[model samples]
Target chain A: MSMEGSIGQDGGSENWGPQVTRKSLMRGGLAALLVAPWTASTLGAGGGRESGGQDAEASGRTRGAGVTDDEIVLGVSAAFSGPSRGLGAELYRGATAYFNHVNANGGIEGRRITLKLYDDGYQPDPCVQNTMRLMLEDKVFLLFGYVGTPTVTRVLPILKKFQNEDIFLFFPFTGAQPQREPPYGDFAFNLRASYNQETAGLVDNLIRIGKRRIAVFYQIDAYGRSGWAGVRAALQKHGEKLAGEATYSRGEKFTGSMRKQVEILQGVSPDAVICIGAYAACAGFARDAVDLGLDVPIANLSFVGSENLLKLLTEGREDAGKYTRQLINSQVVPSYEDTSIPAVREYRELMARHDPQVPEELTREEYTPFAHSFGSLEGFLNARLLAEILRRLGPNPDRAGLEEAVFSVRDFDLGISEKVSFGPDRRQGLQSVYHTVVEEGRFVPLDDWGARFA
Target chain B: MSSASSGVRIRRLFQKTRFGIFAVFGLIVLSTSILCIYTVDTELTAEYEINIQNIAKTIADSSVGILLNRDLATLQSLVDQFLDVQGIEYIYITSESGEFLAHTFVPGIPEEILASDHGSTEPVERSLPGMGDFIEVGSPILAGVAGTAHVGMDLDVVALKIQRAIGQQVYLISVILVLGVLASIWFVNLAAKPLAELLAYAVELARDGEREDLADREILSRDDEAGHLARLFLHVARQGAGRGPAPGVGGRE
Candidate 1:
């Protein structure tokens, strides 16, 4: 088993082409001595990859944790279970679809993007814990694609705590103000319109339709409070106040009854009701509202996951049309059916071709993901924008230079009518809030508010 | 007298008014104090259990929908809110399939709890290794379809409270017993003082063979049985040998 015996045995049997002489052995030793350090340095520089080399540009610049010579890893914590599972699952599916496409087509400067995902089930504590693990344990290059406002609001403080590490979250899927306002705003980059914009648009459009008496139904959490504040501010502009308000605890299910909330809103006799909640609870409220014979225009925000809300409302009911009628939703992303836009067409093709599944560990519930949705489209846009920023960072990206690169993106087009922009003062990339209504089991753009409601 | 009669005499001594009152009152107060302690212990234990059961039921009801969806994070959050209630030590939720979905246990669940059967619907007394005794109550969520939520109420907390109550009761009993003994002694001395003076005067009268009025004015002026008895004794002693009535022999009558 000794090296000399094995060599002698092999040499005695084969009598190989090259004969070993003292001068030849001395020359070989000298050559190996000269090459060993170079080989070691080359392997170390290539991030211990089996591929002996990396990009010439990557070799010349500094890198950060989770950014290897050939890979860039991003961490994500989203609701992969619970009632809002579809939102998280589909969003993840959409982003990974784009990342998969990018990885297939030579990646970003030959460094493939890998998303390290954990399921927080849309709870703040778990999301915070997952964020800590992502930064401390996993050492992800950046936090990306966090879902839900409550989860993101809780994680903002954590980003502040580790500011010395240059840790930043990129394009978390929330429109809450915590990451867009002062104190924590600098730590996060947002791609979605804030809840203020969404609610203001809903309130203004509802008022324009002569529905002056508006009641609000919201989840009793940070997400709900943010949307409520938006509605309050918009109402104050017209010297009006909310007609009435009702709230439901977060993580409520579609199977749960919402008759109490329906009665509360109905008691106020509002002409329209705007709901700030997730899909399951919002769908339940809408269902119960129709059942209770209180017919009014009910609006939901983009975070409500309109596709999932519609599915939950219509899946088992024979009179599904009644539940969806007079329902309006505010979305940050454009409609996926609108192939007129270049990004929409690309998103559709890539989504179909890739068809990514939710990670196996995160899928505890039996949820059928959407083929295409506003949530998924938003996720795709987020991934695409992040890819653009990463590309702008050139081959060697550092955490320290992320803010500069993001701020450099001024009025960049993502193939949509609305141009994406970021600045030193502005943390949100998108400011447009699009309105939609359920039509023929799909959400289409709402063009004329007066015709629809009046 | 035979030993049995002698024993009866000794019992009669204790059956006397002063001795009997002290013995009876003490027995009554001591027994009453003990009964009160027993009642309080029973009531507090029952109340604590009922409080724990009500809390467990509430938690189980709220956990039903979350458990049905298999949302562990929400369930964990739900159970965490109940930890601030007094006597609540820990809470752990099990899935319908008998897997632990959420637990408030730090470090880890004890081997005793992990090894024990969690199928009991009633409260089970558990003794954890490092965590002390607990009254583990389980409420079935969705009638056991969504699994069961188990709440551990610390028995050590209840025991400590009961011990404090007993200490207070002992202090009260001691004060009552001491007060009862002092009151009994003073009452006996009050009643026996006059009788003792009358007995001594009678002994001196018999030994000196002199007819003298009772010197104790208080006893003589009592105007009741003792005064009447004193006047009659003086009258009888002065007229024993003379045929004529010695009316002045009974002085100050």
Candidate 2:
């Protein structure tokens, strides 16, 4: 009853005057203005904002893992013993060539760069296992140059889990969108151009020359899908798209599934066929195509492992010279013949000097072809970038510091004409793409597209 | 007195001094409420559009590779996966020449959505009675051969959300308005307190004439109706004091 009495009857009080004031009016107006933006921003989180790798209670004081007084152990989980091993092996050799030289120079601040390598066989599950072991069991300071899209996508949740500990993954080799964008990009650092960019270049060049009826042959998996998506998007940009398409199941060996794919593509009679698969699989398709009298220009994305594809097409064949000449491949790294480029020159010098056993299967002596490789060149560029960041860490190093140093690599040149840089939102550094064709059993830049193979 | 007469008196009293202030307060409350409700509505619509737009884009961007490689099972699976997402009406992929390649909706999409081309950069929006509102986004499978995709999304969820938000807004605004009106009543009473007290003291003076401390001169100088009444009473009181109040009170002294 007392509580009822305290509130009183609403109509009991006779309303009079003096309640309204200028100040109350202003306050009400201000409240309305302030609450709108507040509500919008609060709800914006459902969709906006980059995913994962945010440290809620971040401290920059602790040193990074796998770092020591005399040595820094880097983790590498690539396809060391699988279908993509040629690419993986070549990439590691390229990075090691640079690391070996740096170590011989007494290393950075008397610390040698050491690698702890794992073979993931280019599979997703194995990649996850290898990455976790490298991070949790092996305690490697950084994860670098792991190949393939399936592996990188599977490694996303692990990266997010270790976000609080400031685990910075450096440069997984696949250019899939997942590793380039949020949730996965939180800890992923990529140095190569995306499959999107590579395919765009291919579509542009093909369209530029009036090659309207284009076909695509791809591997049936994430890697194949990424390249297929890129080419599709690029073709769409010019109001064009794939004329025909065919896919081989993942792990399908060269020429094994080539007949079915060739039949589909040959039926279309396209002016050009853009191939998206590993070197062996693509090479098998090409060998089959040439034999079937489908003599159209064939272009493979950079992910096809260029040198290995040529090796696959040429080796133990009487018509090796004829088979390779019809092949065109996109390159993220420039031609290995151009000595004017500092990065290319550095790669060639490092490979020849340090990893001299690396072979060059050249058909012509037009330029210094000593250990020339697109994959190794990419690896070399990745290493040069890593060494630059490591030197910036001073004597004391930690994951947080490494992350900071990673972003601080602002517009710094590593010999590419396009300035390489990193920012808060930008995870990948290089955007420029190049195209090449095989001439005289060598990967020749596209400027010499129709050069006759001797 | 009858209840009707009492209500009449109350109405008349309210009309005299409280009407203007009530009108102003009522207007402010109504305007603020409308503003808040509209703001909430606009924000909700924006959020829905942004989310739908992003979904359309992500699907279009992601579908290219599978669509181009002619991965039928995977393409259909992707289509079904998108269709499984909440509020997705249908999704379809077509060749550059308008041939249906892969689609989630059977009997296929309507002619309107199917007519979309890769030439347009922005998503095309439409509404149908049974299908609700829809946004169709097209992405070209540019590199494979010649294919484009169109994804249709249902916007009935957005409309439902807006309706629900409006109901909440009305409820919240009604409560705030009621509380505010009550507080306004209290505020006006406080402002009128001095006038009420002056009137009561004047009544006491009339019952027992010539009280020295009854009149308040400061209130007479105020600019309100209470001040005007106070001034008139002081003038009459001065005249009475001058005329014969002292002679009447002499015997008592």
Candidate 3:
């Protein structure tokens, strides 16, 4: 068929013509001019991009750069679209809500805080991309509430390049040791407990309980290596070595890995097993141990938080209950289930006001208050500490002034945890651990063993 | 007899004039009407998709906070609140193990929908206020605790919003189409007046056999296909009236 004929047959040609008159064309052109602006205005109204009637001063309070009149911009990068997207989103929500509350209450010292968030997708490449964008494009004054171990590691070089630039990388979600170390590290602060501290705390309680033979299951990454080193160092005090050790890849299905680890553990017949991965793997290991008839008590670091583990164990409730009766866990942060603590009360209240849909009851079945979220409270504490330091800088804090202010932080106490002390040698404040055992499917504290490892 | 012939010729001329005017007006009106309808439909569809996406992002962010806080009650309450949101049809919160934690609708979601590994199982994405398919946000609880908190939102409300937007555009386009048709008809009639006058002059020349005076004149000056057709018609009339053949007559035939 001819091109025009085919086009006409297709019904599109009906929309065009050679018979159009000059007069009608003029009318159509005028109509287009009149319609174009009206359509654009309607679209702008419907799309919600036009911030009509919103106070510019209030909006400016969010986008302001570098300690402006009534606002401070903070940068954040987290995995908002990958496997860790859930955790990243949660952390962002918690931090954002808290900031919103603070902003609503006239902000910190007359300056409202705004968070510039970028999604890293839980990968190193995206982490670097997002970090650079936030630092260069957004020109945020400081970085805060970043999550993930590899992502933090990937961004270290870029962060170092910006070291002399006077930007602070504060309260990254990961507790990796290098983030707290020198040369490659300095200026970066962590709110979570170091793996060494967590593992040492786990070993300390194990030694006290008279469980000598222990096997460690780790994820073979920076997170795992740090915990393993701490475990070995803590065991060395008693002149002992791990009974057996196994490592697995992150995000691997735990069924086969758990079976293989159980077999290896069976050879050593350790009195206890320490898992240093996520709760899903821990649950898999617990289930496999039961199937293998290895009724040894299982212990895990803070990474295997209670909420996720409980949910996983609840899947095979009857069998899991029998095997996990003596399951124990070490925590670096206060338990959300512990209502008596001031931090827990504040956390509950904050959740209520900012996110009314979240449950008020802090139960083991519903909530997992691990070092990450708990550590975020540490971020809250750090933000407060930084605000104080900014105030002490007396109006305009330079890089050197902020540095001196941080070093002078001594015995600053927040209600949830113990006193935080920072000096020349000690940058990480409040090194403490809480020991708990599962009783009726919940972690119950065994002793007042806070800061025993420290 | 000549008077009767004149009456018959007038009747024929009137019929031809009416038919020609109507055909030209119809073509112009139909073309303008069709163009307006097509453009408006395309624009409205694009707007609907954008609205759905924005709403989805907002709902996803809010649900993430609930999971992180480990507030199951709050998570449940949020699911309920989502149902009331302008474009949401259904919302569900589930564990990683495929257990329903909370939902806005009472009818239980199929286990397959919760556990299906199909990538398309993710709800159809739309860009409407409070409209989107299901989005799952899983937060790991306590250090050893392994479970996912999943939130699912239905996009029916978003679909409805899209329909409403399209409907509004359709109405507006219909109004424009009607006005465009009327304007096109008026314009075609005005343009056809000169052509009708030319046809009358040709008829007068044919009757009086005054071919000598028409030798230097042509119907249309521009060298276009339409001009060519007008020239052909005038040449044919002159030749058919027993006038000498035109210079391009052999080639044209």
Candidate 4:
């Protein structure tokens, strides 16, 4: 299949609040706000105060990292143009949509939030360079919504280097164990449940349903290994092991890797296949499985980008192979279609209200798809959590204050299934995971699995 | 308010003793540590109760087949995995009739669990201080038959974890307090030293009716509370004896 890793899973992955502060424009520091888009070029030279030296009690706004009197600027270094473009682009859009919505509603304590992005192009090497630029050159208040495992691996060491500066990297778009584990995770906070939680739900559900001969299809990298290890652990819980396994190289494009995997998987004819890769490749494997008359269901981990993979599997047709039925994609977030959850409804309303434009190539329905994307939905969830935490920082907000505020978010409801929480020793958010099966171009919850297609 | 001046209080014999000072601050440190541990322990217990319930739910949620097929061997082995997990007391499965089918513990059901309707997967915690602190979770194994999965977790694990965390924090707090005590002791000595020197100079001047330079006492050069007291002492010594060095005793160096 020529459509390998290069193909965008975009079904995957803001604003200068005022890059430069208008010094004493109003008699009071925060009495009034300038309703203007912040440009990064004129980053205020006024916040010359030394790091952690300026106490919150010293002024109305503590000057450190990306905070100033009027607004806070958040920096991101994710692939908006390359392999993981979908995840990066959608995550940004989702967070920005919420930020814009908040700003329109008078912002946090009258200080608006701004997001600045550095395109790492889904490559780790660029991640190293781009993070430096974001940290030193851009001086974002905090880094948010980073995408990809390779990128996070490079960012962690650099994060440690600048740890003393009181900057927190919030909600990186990775479930890789490294970011969730200690030491590397000290400066990191995660919004999504880890891949381990996702795969455990997937493998456990499958095993419960009598799918004994479980196989795995994974990308050949840390991301793939994370899902693989989770599946192995979950199976071992059932006193079982993997029936078969296959792997594809990272960032490898259209390289008959799916064909080789199909050849390897068909021999064992596993009862179910748990795939961990980008949408294009995982969809290719599922498509080839269907074409080859492999009757068993081919499930994918959340990393497969549910909608992106579904679009590829269905290819614009609702009834292709009855194939969508055979596909079970585990998710870190609830399905976009299930609007009963307050967070999901808010996500749809906020997305539709704030960012109404759909890309020209997509049909209105496909672009919106029950008016949601799993990636955007997740992004929206993260933004909501971020906003709630920022609100808890009170009037004199700083990175240190923000960290304290985040830790105080105990059992805070995010309107979605998972309750967001943080502690002095706890960093990850949303321990709960959900599973979905595709039905007519939509991902329906797995608990609703048998009833719909019946 | 006890309006006795702090100077008089500090000069009191009991207050000047190391044991008295340690008792005052040490009680505060001990009380604060105990209060913090109590608060943290309560929060950890609540959080872990939910965690144990969720774990039980996850186990039952994944056991739909074993329970459906009535596979006792798989059930025992599956629940056995949790045996090695810290804090879990027992994992038991029951038939629709409330009979114990398989268990990680001995071949019996707890009288407390068997007394309730095992149909509900809802988790309940019982704090039997002498017996054991336990959270028993029950999940429906079958749709109609009402077979259930039960897991009981001991809350002592969470208490132990909190104790360890608080223990580490208390250790650090003790280190900081020790340093603070040592600093206070040095400061108390520092204040007493300059006072003693000034008083000795004042006595010598009053007795001999002669002026001596208190400025040579090093501490008088440094501006501080002691220096201010030293200057006052010199003035008092001159006033009590004579304004001009008794016309001959010494020059104002």
**Root-mean-square deviation of candidate 1:** 20.8
Superpose all Cα atoms of candidate 4 onto the true structure and report the RMSD in Å to 1 decimal: 23.7
For B116-165, candidate 3 gives per-residue lDDT tens digits of 53222233432323333543323332211323333343445434655576
Q: What does candidate 2 score on TM?
A: 0.56
- Counted clashes in each candidate structure: 0, 18, 28, 12
Residue A202 lDDT (model 1): 93
Say which candidate scores most in lDDT. Answer: 1
lDDT per residue for candidate 2 within B83-183, as digits (tens), equals 65776777666666666555654222444554556435356677754466776665555632456655666667666777788878877767877787788
User: 2 or 4, which is superior by TM-score?
Assistant: 2
Chain A accuracy as TM-score for every candidate: 0.86, 0.80, 0.75, 0.81
Q: What tens-digit string does per-residue lDDT give for candidate 1 at A1-454?
A: 0000011111110111123343542452322212111111000111221222223243323256757666676878888889888888878878877887887787788877766567888987677767765665456788999998778877887788779988898888777777876667899999988888998999998998899999888886667757876787789887888887777878999999889888877878999999989999999999899989989999999999999999888887787787998899999999999999999999999888878777454566798888899988988999899999999989778888899999999989988998888998988988899999989889999999999998
**What is candidate 2's CA lDDT for residue B40?**
77
Give the DockQ-based CAPRI class for model 1.
Answer: incorrect
How high is the CA lDDT of each candidate model?
0.75, 0.65, 0.54, 0.65
Residue A212 error, candidate 1, Å = 0.9
Q: Is the docking of candidate 4 incorrect, acceptable, medium or high quality?
A: incorrect
Which candidate comes out best when scored by TM-score? 1
lDDT of 4 by residue, A194-228 (tens): 88788888777777677888988876555665676
Sliding window of 10 residues with minimal summed lDDT for model 1 chain A: A1-10
Model 1 alpha-carbon miss at residue A362, Å: 1.1
